[model samples]
Target: MTNQSNNSVKKTVLVTGAAGFIGFHLAKKLLSEGHSVIGLDNINDYYDINLKYARLLELGIEKNEAETYNNLCNSKTHNSFSFIKMNIEDREALPILFKNQDIHIVCNLAAQAGVRYSIENPEAYVDSNVTGFLNILECCRHHNIKHLVYASSSSVYGLNKKIPFSTDDNVDNPISLYAATKKSNELMAHTYSHLFKIPTTGLRFFTVYGPWGRPDMALFLFTDAISKNKPIKVFNNGQMERDFTYVDDIVEGVTRIINKETAERIQSNKFYKIYNIGNNNSVKLLDFIKEIEINMGKEAEKLMLPMQPGDVERTWANVDDLIKDYDYRPNTSIKNGVKNFVQWYNKYYNS
Candidate 1:
């Protein structure tokens, strides 16, 4: 971990998907840095609503109290942070939020985020990731947001045999609808940056896991199954690998970009950039499971299965651009990261 760097001047920042794992952590980080943060999420039931509510609970917003959509709920723990229950695709409401909140920086982290789920529910991906991101770009254009930071995905590098996926590498061959939408987000952001001159940066995140993670993610699902003595379905017959970046490292990279001054990022052509934020260390599935088992003090009963649809064999991120620009490097190893997650899971679930 690096020293906490405060923003030169505190600005009003809006974080979409505030109830989600990454959003919640980023919002918390910004608020702790003394910035006024307005978090927005529809609180969808993609995985577990209770888990979402628990994340909100950590942000000091009572789940029952955040009922009204688009209505702001002040955080009980911090004066600078507030949250709202809303969908980003709401065309009419999104613009109103930008104008009313006086938002300076827009962090678009909300999306229908599951490669496999995108196979079954394609419309959900288009509606949220595509249409919703368009709405965000429109709002940033009209309201003159200083900078727009959005989440991209490592899945965009689908089927690439390259060792380390770079931002400069070709990502046109997306294997899943989820990856396609995220790639579309990068294209959309570039267009907006060129036309409207809205400074935008897209981050392609690798497998992010830690406390308060989504239950649908591999780490959380495997942890839960192992704790309950249930058989965990390991896809690809446990022959997969992922550059599992820790949640705090992702947040650190995001905040560094968000706090960057306008002069620091204005490129010659357009104020648009993309960076991959990953640990740069890929670990195999079996080794990752071993770390989890060691942390939990129980070995998982694994059910080896072939790869499912919309799945990839491996993903590795080349974070050279992120390192060169932001001086950010993911430091948390899988051992410590899994330990932290297991500790949180045990305490949160009283298992």
Candidate 2:
């Protein structure tokens, strides 16, 4: 392990979705690397704020202390970690934060994320994902930030019959509003990178799941329902498949890419890059549930149903670019990943 105290040239990183599933883990990892991290999130009530608070609690920010928006709370546990409760779409406050924090690298993981929820609330997608991203681009442009890495999604490969989706493949056919917003983020990032020379890397994350996972994700929902002996919803009659990457794998890839020196981008005059960060293995929905069931020692009663709107049939990622550049390979198997999640779930909920 690198002794964090002896390291010089520590960059100050601003993680927008610090309270999110991936963001929390990334913030923790960066802090351990001796970088000063300024965590930001709206702490929305999309699912349960309790989970978000719990993640912040792990980052050394208490729920009561994090209630005040725009107030920076330094971490008692790690001096390098601090948090602020703020929305990315807040144009006024967001720029002020960028200026005040002197943030060099930005990881924009904040957004209204959900396929089904976007169907009824399309405006929310435009508000947070589009408008919020635009604000981030503008801030990076004006603030002279070095790199802007934002979260894209595999849903951008919507309706494509190709297996093992690649970053070079065309992503114009987004099936849902959420997918559309993610694609828009990529486009916006490229434009800013080209026009303003802000080096940007967009990660099209597969179905990421593990400990401290989001309650609305498939793995979390399945584990929660099965543990309580409630029936789990099986969409597409258990035929759907997903490239479920573990959260730690995603964080490792992001952290490496953040520090991987991008002088080549300037040499080539292309300051933009996108990569698919995934496990590279697609597992059936039913098989995934089986892993959860085995880990929990409980079988779930599944409610079989047709595929819902804004949902894809399957997702498989081709991580050749990620491995080629950053040498990122997601190594967690579904069984072990599920076991990790179940262990954390039991401890967190005392179930």
Candidate 3:
């Protein structure tokens, strides 16, 4: 029999924020890969609690059973999936979770997401993104965790005019508090990786959109308004740009990163790395709306507006590194991506 210090070769993976848009997709992919997954989410009322519960239901996790603390719902689809209703900020609870589970890989996806919201409720961002992530990193270091991958946002690329935002670009000048915190997370992760010799990968995700996406994002918001025959706010007077990567593509890129573990310790300076997971295609905001108009069979009543304070004029990604190392392929075109999202929205809401 073979034995090692890491304990059972981490047959199970622990994913935080299993109920969130990206987190839900990530957990689903992990389960599909035949990995025993332990997912955690407090199911906060950040957006609609109903949507969060609905996602849990799709994973074959009973919403009723999630009523308890650390509620675990076995995945009917994968049988290896389990869930917990614990908050990421709960320091006491996390240590218990790490100690109890044979979690080899840790994906920290829990955070109070939203740039505009971060400006209003800075405390929420600090608690979840900073404090919560700290606990996750500490747990990983203490438990001899093999690899830790966490979500960092493209919002971290705030105030930068660099074309196709790359990992080599300087990201210290974040315009919004949300962006600042996200950039801080990258720095924090780097510190832990260097100091603890833990391999960490941070993904600077572009404007990710698709089925079960956040209502606040442009694709979801625009689709919802247009389908209801309502006016859609065209920010920057419809002169903005975004790299709207599809949800499935993002999941595929992330899944590959998980299994292909980093050999160099973050301290190796070579071990710690960041990648921009996005479609190289940057669609103009107006073109994106047009795609929606065509897809939904309704022309949006446009309300032209200047860019929001925390918003940037454009965001493009240079995914050369991602392709070179991981062959990260983001294949969903905006038209198809929007079409898929609208389909899910209509079916889910019975619109």
Candidate 4:
């Protein structure tokens, strides 16, 4: 890590899944803060490849250059930001990239996301989330990376009736393959931390939403359906509840964890830590939709439906640990968050 100022250290950070929703935001934030960021993503067609490409465009990597696999494309917008078209599961390529890049820290955000999709494509989950994560761990172990910050999901609290999910909660009984994989990540991170003494922090994010959000998430889907006069599926008869954290808040928590000295926070010889990053307040599903309706100036034709398979009823994260350690809590209200997304959505689609 190179000292940029008395208060900040500039690091060469490897941000995998850089084309993904949260990863894109984190990479941009890191670059703005004077860090050298290497953004990597396979650009898999899990959703819209164009959206991923558009995100890369925001980072100044042209679509033509971004499409080339195993090649590093320097950003035209930010000199400190570079992107590579690669998969973390590529055991051969990942190590070489690490060796060549001299990455001081790694924030592994690449994973096969979507809970329901995991059921339809179980093998995809194993390949990306399990095998791919193992490759990242191996690279970190060999390269002596200063810190590893990985994304964990709120779905890991599967089947737990607890209102506010805590890091101390028993997450052994995961309902979905997606949840199982995220739980597996936490366990894997713990093992690496314990064995190799790698300082690893896993952030279990809850219902992240805002600009450049995933098209599959409820906010994006609902906003799209409502705008198009299509019926939005209200699962569990709109009885769901979520923490509904904003993207900016999630990025803030991640950057703080990344910049903080790993040794200062870890316990005696224990280099593993996990924190739930959320809004710290759960909002009712119907109310959340109403906020979207207000922002979009259109009401959604909701198709009240039964709960889908592999879906949990509610998720409320206990972010006390994050507040205690970083003196930060996700404060973005759903009202403002929804409005921001709607504004971005209208502008993005209109343009």
lDDT by candidate, in order shown: 0.89, 0.88, 0.84, 0.89
Name the best candidate (by TM-score). 1
Q: For residues 84-194, could you state the per-residue lDDT of candidate 4 as single tens digits?
A: 888899988888888777899999999999999998999999999999999999999999999999999999988789788999999999889999999999999999998
* Cα-based TM-score, every candidate: 0.96, 0.95, 0.93, 0.96
Q: What is the clash count of model 2?
A: 0
Per-candidate RMSD vs. true structure? 1.7, 2.5, 4.6, 2.9
What is the C-alpha lDDT profile of model 1 across 98-127, one tens digit per residue? Answer: 777789899999999999999999999999
Model 3, residue 69: displacement in angstroms? 4.8
Question: 1-351 in candidate 2: lDDT tens per residue?
Answer: 111133436789999989999999999888888788988888999989999999999988888877854553332334788788888899888888777777889999999999999999999899999999999999999998988999999999998888889887889999999999999999999888888888999999999999999889999999889878899999999999999988888898898877765678878887999899999989999899999989989789999999999898999999998888877777888888999999999999995
TM-score between candidate 3 and the true structure: 0.93
TM-score of 4: 0.96
Enumerate residue pairs that collide in model 3: none
For candidate 4, give the lDDT of residue 336.
87
User: Which ranges of candidate 3 are over 4 A from the true structure?
Assistant: 1-10, 69-78, 264-269
- Candidate 2 local accuracy as lDDT? 0.88
